[model samples]
Target: MDCIHLTGIRSYGYTGYLPEEQILGQWFEVDVKLWLDLSSSGETDAIEDTVDYRSIISLVQDSVKTSKFALVERLTASIADSILALSDRVTQVQVILSKPAAPIPDFSGKISIDIIKKR
Candidate 1:
């Protein structure tokens, strides 16, 4: 299957376990991989034949911006499901959700969840 990779997507979200995080919100990042047949688009070179990635990016940004979930897993699942619903060409999706400013004391690393879904 042909795939499109969207990387380094960043947005602010209120999804976190801590009470302060839920109130204050924080920044998050996402990387998505979408799989589908691009041969038609490649041949036709028409806008209708290929996925309009702007819509995908908008969907992701809107999702992260308006959600208030407690776990990255839930957010990722929602994103994958929404992407599937948004486009008929998408046969599979992979979502990687990241928390760069986790509230864990004395930690300077990032946390991310990776999941794949197939239609």
Candidate 2:
């Protein structure tokens, strides 16, 4: 299947195990890959023939900004599910959520979770 890759989506959200994280919020980055047939779009060269990625980006941003999930795993799954709900043409989706500001002490590395959903 063909894939649409959307990367570096940044948003401020309040999702974390720590109390301060939920209250103060932090920046989150999301990367999504959508798998679907691109033949029709390639043939017709029309916007309607393919998924509008603006919706996906907006959804990802919204999910991160408004969600209260404590687990990044859950958040990634939710994103995959939500994206799958957006279009019937999408056969599969991969979501990679990155938490660059994790609350772990004495840690300078980032944390990320990747999940894939298939229709």
lDDT of 1 by residue, 1-119 (tens): 99999999999999888888889999999999999999999999997987999999999999999999988889999999999999999999999999998999999999999989999
Task: Give me the displacement of residue 51 in model 2, in angstroms.
Answer: 0.5
Whole-model Cα lDDT per candidate? Answer: 0.93, 0.94
User: Model 2: per-residue lDDT, tens digit, 16-61?
Assistant: 8888888999999999999999999999999899999999999999
The list of candidate 1 runs beyond 4 A from truth reads: none
What are the models' TM-scores?
0.98, 0.98
